[model samples]
Target: MDKCKVDVAIIGAGTAGMGAYRAARAHTENVVMIEGGPFGTTCARVGCMPSKLLIAAAEAAHDMKHAELFGVYPGDVRIDGKAVMERVRRERDRFVGFVLEAVESFPEKHRLKGHARFLDAHRLQVAENCEVEAGRIIIATGSRPNIPQMLKAAGDRLIVNDDVFSFDDLPDSVAVFGPGVIGLELGQALSRLGVRVRMFGASGGLGAIRDEKIRDYALQVFNEEFPLDPAASVSSVERTEEGVAVTFEDGDRGTVTETFEYLLAATGRRPNVDDLDLQNSDLELDDRGLPLFDRYTLQCGSSHIFMTGDANNDLPLLHEAADEGRIAGENAGRYPEVRAGSRRAPLAIVFTDPQIAVVGMNIQQAHDHCGGCFEVGEVSFEGQGRSRVLGKNKGLLRVYGERGSGLFLGAEMFGPAAEHLAHLLAWSVQNRMTVPDMLGMPYYHPVIEEGLRSALRDLNRRLLMGPESVERCLDCGPGA
Candidate 1:
């Protein structure tokens, strides 16, 4: 058995772990990273990147299918399922390769290959190969998909988002459970790619969208693409001779039975801290057994330990995970002089059609944060010039601002180019821009961003923040 002492030890080699490793190395060379799984980011292996590749293919197919709307009829659209899966796998491997290269570039002595669990507060046992005693620790072990026992009834037919990127060919049909980010994106991509898809959700929610208007608009828009019933009444799920069989309420059809090649469990993810034997440690833990750590510092209960990434369960997004890892690593490296890391405004985007983005606070969050002293500014893309011109005229956007300060609190949207718009709004929120300040920015003619300006104008007027328009008003050139 090999034994070593290090100043910092980081568990897991995903995005967060890598970031922590880099940050810790800056302060001292006495650092090591332990990972039991493959060296690659979740975004690269199974999360964002591969999913976007599939979505790109789906978008191509969808545009070709709808070309007739532009008076250019595409005679026949034949989807090569094998080809689609091939490209997804090929590009996915390339992305994973880059991550592997990064990990390999680190000193081989700094890498340990095994699952690590806490022996005590400062000791870690790495799969019988090595014993590590460190002054400080960072748990960036990441997360795995959470599957309920009910979905286990699908037996061998059950799969998760991680398994989708490795398909040899697209299945004929899929029954996707969970209307969250993974489910919505994969379900819509499959539906658009000529696969019969039925999506179900236990609760009435759409990804990170908390505003009721955007949620309902998203639900309606996506259902038109595939059968999605949030708050669904699912009777049973059983393994059939051919595939997985699911019996559920199908609107007016009233409880129908359907069988699909795969039953995707996109429910959610659980922190990977469970297998770490956290009970042996002196650190404080939540009821779920996860460590109670400071969000700003990623420090675990005033102890020498820290938690970051999905392991902490604070914010599961890759960017947030990276940020937390950096903070945790920096604090762990400097020990006893832990400082708060700069946290950016919240931003989330779902890459579905008419994409969904939530920046800063939602309506409920705004109201709670401001004690109901907030006003809403809204815009429907149905009448927006650019959206209508592009035949993508659907969805809604709502921006929230404080009533007194007129500060741009947040914005949520289900519309074309929402990902781009969300970035702009996220920057605005981070900069503490007011409604009038945002409106003062130049908006060019005949653009979707004019929709944002229109909403800002409404918010400014309602908050009495900006002077009224002087010339040919009409809310800036008919929604610009």
Candidate 2:
């Protein structure tokens, strides 16, 4: 067997792996990256980029259909599924090409083209032929969609994100299982594109927003776009001559069997660590078989091994994976004097019609951490000027803050321009800004930002800040 040694060995060429590779290379040129196939990162190839392409197309179709609201009626409207998929694939390939080029830029010998398994703490066996010895290792193998074994019986009728973008044509109808981020996004997009879509979630929430009010608002908005059953408990899935049959029980509706041309299993994802032969190492495994690693340092129990990205199963978003990868790579290269890394405040967004955003702590987290110490402020978009003008005057925004110090805690909202609002809130939370500080900032008239100001004003009213202090601040000079 061939033998090789490197300063750092990164397994998986996805976003996290690539992030680690770039960082490790800064410390030493003797860095290598290994992957089996499908060189593009997951976000560009399947998760974020391709999904957004479909969503954008669906949004365009929806806008054209709704143009009548503005007294502008364009004649007949038709959608060609084949053309839409082709555009998505064409644009997606461009993004993937960039990643492929970056990977190929590395020396051919440094780019191992095969699966790698752990032989020992500091050793790896690649594809049964080559062996690699590295001073430190970064495992950023990313993740794969987790489909239940029961659904495998459907054969080609079942689809996951990995293969959904490659379809030659759209299905006539689809029943999406698990109304998480992927399920809701695709389900609504397909519905807008004229495909009959139904979504089911075992839990009582849509996407990852746990705030009850925000979830209810999301349900209301999503219900208008497509059928959603959050209380559904899937019982069975079977193949049919024409398509696939699904049996499920809903709290509102009794046991029902529905047939759809295709089934999408967005049931979540599992870290790609099972095939890495982690058992051969001394690192302790969790109940889910993930390595026990420090969140701040991204280092596993073994000093020579580090875990990052989706492989750690902390936050599976692409941006989070990239940040974790940088942390892991930096610490791995700086071994004995490991440095801690600070992560950004929690920020998650679901790109549905009105959009769903959860910045920092949600209601449940705030309640659990602060109990009654936190005050909630809210505003409904029903009467908001900008929202009504744009025909998006439906949904709600809720902001949470400490009652005494008025420190911004977190926020969850379902409203127009929610993505922007979520980022503003996340940035404020990261900087530990207080409610008064936010209110002191300028809020443009007839803009969605006014909704945030209204919520903050409500919070300020409930805060313990004295009236004198409030007045003093209100009358203070601009520089003060």
Estimated TM-score for each candidate:
0.98, 0.95
Q: List the residue pairs that clash in candidate 2.
A: none
By lDDT, the best candidate is 1
Q: Could you tell me the C-alpha RMSD of candidate 2 in Å? A: 3.6
Q: Poorest 10 consecutive residues of model 2 by lDDT?
A: 471-480
Residues 1-480, model 1: lDDT tens digits: 899999999999999999999999999999999998888889999999999999999999999999999999988999999999999999999999999999999999999999999999999999988899999999999999999999999998999998898899999999999999999999999999999999998988878889998898888888788989889999999999989999998768897999999999999999998889999889888888888889999998889999999988888999998899899889999998999999999999999998999999999999999999999988898988888889988979999999888899999999999999999999999999988788778777678988888788777778976584522246544555
Model 2 TM? 0.95
Query: Model 1: how far is 177 from its true place, Å?
Result: 0.4
RMSD of each: 1.3, 3.6
Task: Give one digit per residue, the lDDT tens place, for model 2 in 1-480.
Answer: 999999899999999998898888888889899897689999999989999999999999998999899998987779999999999999999999998999898888779988999999889998989999999999999899999898887788999987779988877999898889999889899999999998988767688888887888788778887879887778998999979998988666788888999999999999899999999877899998889999889998747889999989899998899899999888887786688888999999999888888999999898887877899988888777677778877878889998777799999988889999999999999999999898888766568777778777777777766441233123221111
Task: List runs of model 2 lying over 4 Å from the truth.
Answer: 250-253, 466-480
- Candidate 1 weakest lDDT stretch, 10 residues: 468-477
Query: Residue 249 in model 2: shift from native, Å?
Result: 3.6
